[model samples]
Target chain A: GAGVSQTPSNKVTEKGKYVELRCDPISGHTALYWYRQSLGQGPEFLIYFQGTGAADDSGLPNDRFFAVRPEGSVSTLKIQRTERGDSAVYLCASSLMPNSPLHFGNGTRLTVT
Target chain B: GESVGLHLPTLSVQEGDNSIINCAYSNSASDYFIWYKQESGKGPQFIIDIRSNMDKRQGQRVTVLLNKTVKHLSLQIAATQPGDSAVYFCAEKGLDGATNKLIFGTGTLLAVQP
Candidate 1:
């Protein structure tokens, strides 16, 4: 694709439910990142991947949040036992290489009711 | 833990006027910086980028100035337009050997009144 793409533009789930957000980055991009944006705030880094491995996952809020880039192209962010505080926009970005300008997707808005 | 912050939370400028948004970063070791514009219901768009080696960089209607000495960065928009109304954010990239990670700052909402 020409730009980064995210699935389920909007998702509403009950508290404690499991939810997954998918992201498809631009072709051949070696770096992918996941971020969470709360209302009235900037996007906060969640995790970063270089190729198929997660080079940085320190930003994940807790053990309930996890992400994977299995094929180095498509990525998934899984949230277990989602809480009401998890209601926010999940953003995905891809870069040609590390430190390069990131191209962001429209993001998936997750509402944990 | 490194963090970036913005000095102003909101800025309003008249159409065709020049606008400047400021940011402060605590990490001095960061090597790369970028400016992004995000409108409501949309993702952030890359504006311009600058390296620590350069003090300033200019793009079409945008300019980024970095001051490592004071740990400050600013984005200047020339001839601001109504279409340019959006939230602007500054991000810093810290290099870990061959890898780099971006750390973003609190954003400033820019409203260009026509």
Candidate 2:
């Protein structure tokens, strides 16, 4: 079975720019999540979506970060006015349901210079 | 605040030897715990998961032991192999109205010596 897939394995942008990371969840997964991992640290929760609606967005650091899953499967994480502090690997994961074990994709590493 | 932490930053073991990784969590209300293995430049992969009600759970060559009384978690790998070398992290599911969120620990790197 196909696992969760993320596009643009690596992205480099200038500060104050905007970038979008894409995630394609598993065929039937009903839940999708986004996390950020800094150097030498564990992944930090960012946002989560159930079906087409975001179930939880509290983990999002600020208003600059926003995510959407319009068709209920493909998701996009958008960052506005990126900062060097935002440099990190952005991970995407999906599960069959809310409580199911999540399957992760080889995240998209974003670097803001 | 929900925080899960590891006891060791790194663990080195000989191939074929048993390996043990320990973790401690702060939220006693957490009922679900999971172990994940992450290789360099790759995302985390699920190893095993256990509920608070169970003290121990076993998989192919891995076992997870949980001590709720002390808020401790341990992962044991029997006959460790080089392929098992990677960073191991224990994550606890938060109960603060964000059930889908998982609080992860600062991972423990496992290096298998041949």
Candidate 3:
């Protein structure tokens, strides 16, 4: 079975630009999560969706970070006016249900110059 | 503020030696915990998990011990191999309804010398 899939394995952009990262969760997974990880650090929570709606968005750093999961499957994490501080690996994970062990994708490395 | 932290930043051991990684969490409401392993260019991979009700759980070549009294968790790997070299993280999730997002601690890098 295919694991969680993330697009644009690497993305390099200038500061103040807009970028979108996509995630495809495992089949039948109802819970999807996004996290950001810096060098030599653990992943930090971002947002999660239980189905089509976000169950929690509190982990989002600011208003510039937004995510959406339409039709209960594919999800896109959008960032507005990217900054150098946002340069990190963006990870996506999914589970069979809430509280279940998460299966993670390789992640998209976003580099804002 | 609630947080999860590790006691060690790195551990270097010879292959065939056992390895232990420790974590401390501040949120007493947290009922579930997990250990994840990550390599250089990949995301975390689930290693093992334990619930608050249980004190210990064992998986292949690994064991997770939980001590709610001290708010501590530890992951032990038996006869560690070269392939076990990676960064290990401990994640905690509180019992807050359907929102199961995890709070992760700073990782510990395990370097195995074969």
- Tell me the tens digit of each residue's lDDT in model 1 across B18-100: 99999998788887889989998888999999989899999999889999999999999999999999999899877665445
Clash count for candidate 2 is 0
- Candidates in order have lDDT scores of 0.90, 0.94, 0.94
**Candidate 2 chain B: 10-residue stretch with minimal lDDT:** B1-10
Q: Model 2 clash pairs?
A: none
User: On residues A1-113, what C-alpha lDDT tens digit does candidate 1 reach at each position?
Assistant: 48999999999999999999999999999999999988767789999999999998888999999999888999999999999999999999999988679999999999999
* Cα misplacement distance, residue B44 of candidate 2 (Å): 0.3
TM-score of each: 0.94, 0.95, 0.95
lDDT of 3 at B46: 98
What TM value does chain A in model 1 reach?
A: 0.98
Clashing pairs in 3: none
Q: Candidate 1: which stretches are off by over 4 Å?
A: B1-8
Q: Order the numbered candidates by DockQ, best leading.
A: 2, 3, 1
Model 3 residue B35 CA deviation (Å) reads 0.2
True contacts kept of 1: 0.57
lDDT of each residue in B1-114, candidate 2, tens digit only: 433443448999999999999999879999899999999999999999999889999999999999999999999999999999999999998545556898899889999999
